[model samples]
Structures are given as structure tokens and as C-alpha cells.
Target: MSALAPDPRFVSQAPGPGQRSPFLRRLAHASEPWLYSAPALILIVAVMLVPLVLGISYAFRDVRLLNPFSGGYVGLQHFHELARDKAFWGALKNTLWWTGASVFLQFFLGLFLALLLDKPFYGRGIAQALCFLPWAVPSFLSGLNWAWLFNPVVGPLPHWMVSLGLMSQPENILSDPTLAMWGPIIANVWWGIPFFAITLLAALQSIPRDLYEAAAIDGAGGVQRFFSITLPFLAPTIAITVLLRTVWISNFADLIVVMTSGGPANRTQIVASYIFTQAFKKLDFGYASAVALVLLVLLLAYSMLIVLLRQSLLKKG
Candidate 1:
């Protein structure tokens, strides 16, 4: 029996001394990057992902803040109520208007400013800084400032409108249901335009100077060169910025909350402000979460649609 000599294959398969097994070595190699990133990953999971999951779960549960025993599961009852909520429907419509008008004004005005800033001029640096001043201001402060401007008592905007025949007389537009949404919309546009201006200016500067020069030499007009070269060069940037800004503006409640508090009979209540009202004012955390989830889904669908359209346009180009 002489130690029925160990098979050479088995001997070769086993790790010797303190050496790691092949499986362990492979796992260590694979996990090295994750080990380095563990802190950030853990922080994100704790701060963002955990809350997100909890919020989604709350959407299906009766998690009213006023009630101690309100954590019971309610399934889709909140959503069912949302379906019949006229206020929710109205807010959704207002959300569409708010997002569309704000994004449209911001992008075009910002593009114009970007184009103007891209050109060389004396005191251009000062001009650029002044143009971007609005964005540097906090949203809350901007909202307050704009609110005051819309006030007829101390602010001059209403008086100016009166002088220009845009208004019948000095009055607080924020108190008017027919015009209250415009108050926040104007404030948002002013605050958000600088974001587009900065991003679009960077993209504009990256375009080849020789392309514009060549177009000019070929007797192309400013409009022709812009449409043919500038716009084409800016298409991708425009698409992405528009999509992101649309989503952002849709979720933005700061201006409305500060300026109008979604007031004038909730006429200016956007979905985002409505969510705030439900969550903090009414303490209906479950219903608020449901509305938030619906908003998330809607934004996600919109983003996907925009991405698909961009891809198709790129393919065609």
C-alpha cells in the first residue's frame, strides 16, 4: 500500500504553502476596483438609493405623517384616487405649460445670448459676467426678487407694464389666477437662461472657426451660415440640454412655492408644487409619494422618447 502515491494531476491542482487558490485570485482581481470605490458606492446607496426605495414603497403604503399607525399597505389606492383627482389633472396640465414655456424661452434666449457672447467685443468679459449673474443668484432669492418685481406697491414692473400698455393699471400679477402662473414662469426663465447660455457658449466655442469663415467667404448670409453650420453643430447639445432642462423645470417648485405658493385657487399649482402641498402641508406622505412616482415615470418616458428621437436624427444625418 506504500502511500498509494498521490496522483500528479491532483497534486498540481492544489495550492501550495500560503498561495491563494485560482478561484480566490480571480475574485480578488475582480473586486479590486470595487474595493477602491466602496466608500462612494456605500454612500450613494445609503443616501440616495435607500431613500428612493423607501419612497417608492411609501407610494404603495398609507404613510400619512399625522397618523402613528398609517404604514399599512394600501396597494394602488393612492394611484386610484390620483386618477380621479381633478386637482392632480389640473396640475399635470399646468406642469406641461410650465415646462414647455420655461424651456422654450430659456433655450432660445440663452442661445441668442450665447451667440452674442461668442463674438469679440470691448468689455465682453463684463458683459458675460452680467449675463450669467441671474444663474449665480440662488433660486429662492431670485423668486423673491421676481415676486417683488411683480408687486405693484414698491416694484416698478407693474408700473412699467402699465406705461407700455401691457397692463390696464398697476396690479399684482401673482394674485391673478389668469396670470399667476406667468409670474413663476418668468422668474424661472430668468434664473435658468444662464445655465443654457453657459453650456451653449462652451459648445459654440468648440465649433470650428474656419467653417464659419469659409461660409462667409462663399457669400453665405448670417442666417444661412447659422442655419447650415451653427445649428447643425449645435444639434446634439440642443437636444440634450433641452431634454435635461425640461425635466428639471418640470420638477422645479422653488419659484412657484416662493412666489405664488401655488395660490390663486391653486390655479398656478403645478404637479411639483402640488406634491409639496400634499407632502408637507397635508401630511399625506403616501399620496405625495404616489404623485412623485407618477411624475418620475412621466419624465422617464419623456427622456426615452427624446433619446430615441435624437438617435434617429443622428442616423439620418
Candidate 2:
């Protein structure tokens, strides 16, 4: 019999190149991610980037509120003013204290809480929820609540201090310039601790239980395991969280604004609160923008330094 002609449909054929145009395929592949991210990119540009650029521009121009002819090019005049302003220097110092103390206290307490929560325990879910509830409250509401708590008339804190012989009488610490800054710092720490706890708790959970088991089996102590394994794994998370929190706390003025309004004598006036006072109270948008720009530059420098330090430490390790 003659060889059966190969069925046309079933005949094996060499794979042809992709029928779609190569250029079209390449373009589509390259554009896929951008297409998915376009909405977010556009929103950021419109809301954040645009306002940032405008604010920067205002730094170089006179743009006072309620002034029809105020948008004049001023060229570093605001910076010159800021340099000579005593209040600005005071606020800068206050910002450092506020951010430093708040970040440190929050990080330590949060880490301790995270460690406690990492172990299995009854009612763990409820405990975690209760501890994290502070973060769920609005920042402004937290500020107001803390402010109320500091009131000698209606709050128990002052009375408790007096009863403990820590104070001569029940007094509002918020009115005492020397101690006023502490009030806001305390509030900030209380509100921020949950944030670090939640983040560190998640990081802690991600650690391999096997590592701890192995370390224990090798005769490692609890302290040793934490220092060697837990700490190393948590270093990155701690660094990032601390850096971001520092920046945020420096810019945070709500609690100060609501509690003390910059003080019995501007003792609690951080740069952020000062900026608010300028733009809203004094209606000097240009000056406020200039101050904001200076703060932004300082924060940027701080962030860069932190990143460099982290990279150097990582290299050393």
C-alpha cells in the first residue's frame, strides 16, 4: 500500500513565530504594570505632588492669605526672617525633644508588648485588640482626650499625682511651661505605642519557630536567643519604623495645638505648631510655606543620614 498521505490537520509542523506583531507584544508586556498603577500614580500627582510643588513655590513668593496682591516674588526673604526669629529656634528645639522622647518611649514599650504577645496565651486575640484600640481612635480625638485627662478639675491624673506626694497640689501640668512639653509627648507616646506593637508583633510572628527551638536545643538562653536571633531579624523593622515615626512625630502638632496652643509661653511650640500658628492665626501663608520648606529639608537630611547609617551597618555585618 502506498504511504497514507499525512492528515493535513494532524501533520506535525514546525512552530511558527508568534502571529501577533512583536512590537505590539513587547509594548503590551512593558506597559502592563504601568497600566495597573496609573490611577494611583495620577492620584498622587494630583493630590501630593502638585500641592508640594505649589508650597515650594510659595516659599519663594509672597502669598499671604486674604491679600489680592500678595503673590510677589520674595526670594529668600522668608528664610532670612526665619533665621532671626527667636520663636522659630525655640520651636526647632522643642521639635527635637518631642520627636526623640516620643519615638524612644513608644519603640521600647511597643517592643515589650510585642514580646509579651508573641507567646501563645488564652484570650490573645482580645488582648491584642484591646492594646491596639488606641491606634483605632482618631488622632484629634486622642489629643482632645489626653488634654482632658491633664485637666486638674475633671481629670484624675493630677489628683493621683498629688495623692502620691509627687505634687504639692492638683495642677494642670499643661499650664506649666517647664513641664508643658511633657504633656503632649506623653499623649503622643500613648497613641503611637500601638503602631509599633502591631508592626513588631507581625515581624515577630514571621520569625521561624524552628530557629528558636533549635537554639534552645543547643543550650541557648532566652536572652541569648532574643539578642542573637530575634534582634537580628527585627533590626530592619525597628530601623524603618523608628525613622518614619521620627519624621511623623516631628511634624505632628495636633496634640500640641489642642492641648496647649503652643503654651503658657510657646514652650510646647514645635515647628509644626508654629507653622500652623503662622498660616492660620497670622495668615502669613508665604512665611508658613517657607518654614515648612525648611522643616522638609531638615527631615529629608535626617532620613538620608538614617538610610546611610543603616546601609553602612548592614555592610559591616
What TM-score would every model get versus the actual structure?
0.88, 0.88
Residues 77-188 of candidate 2 have per-residue lDDT tens digits of 9999999999999999999999999999999999999999999999999999999999988888888898889899899999999999989999999998899899999998
lDDT string for model 1 (40-128, tens) is 99999999999999999999999989899899999999999999999999999999999999999999999999999999999999999
lDDT of 1: 0.92
Model 1 misses residue 169 by how many Å? 2.6
Q: In model 1, which runs have C-alpha deviations exceeding 4 angstroms?
A: 1-28, 305-317
Q: Candidate 2 — what's its lDDT? A: 0.90
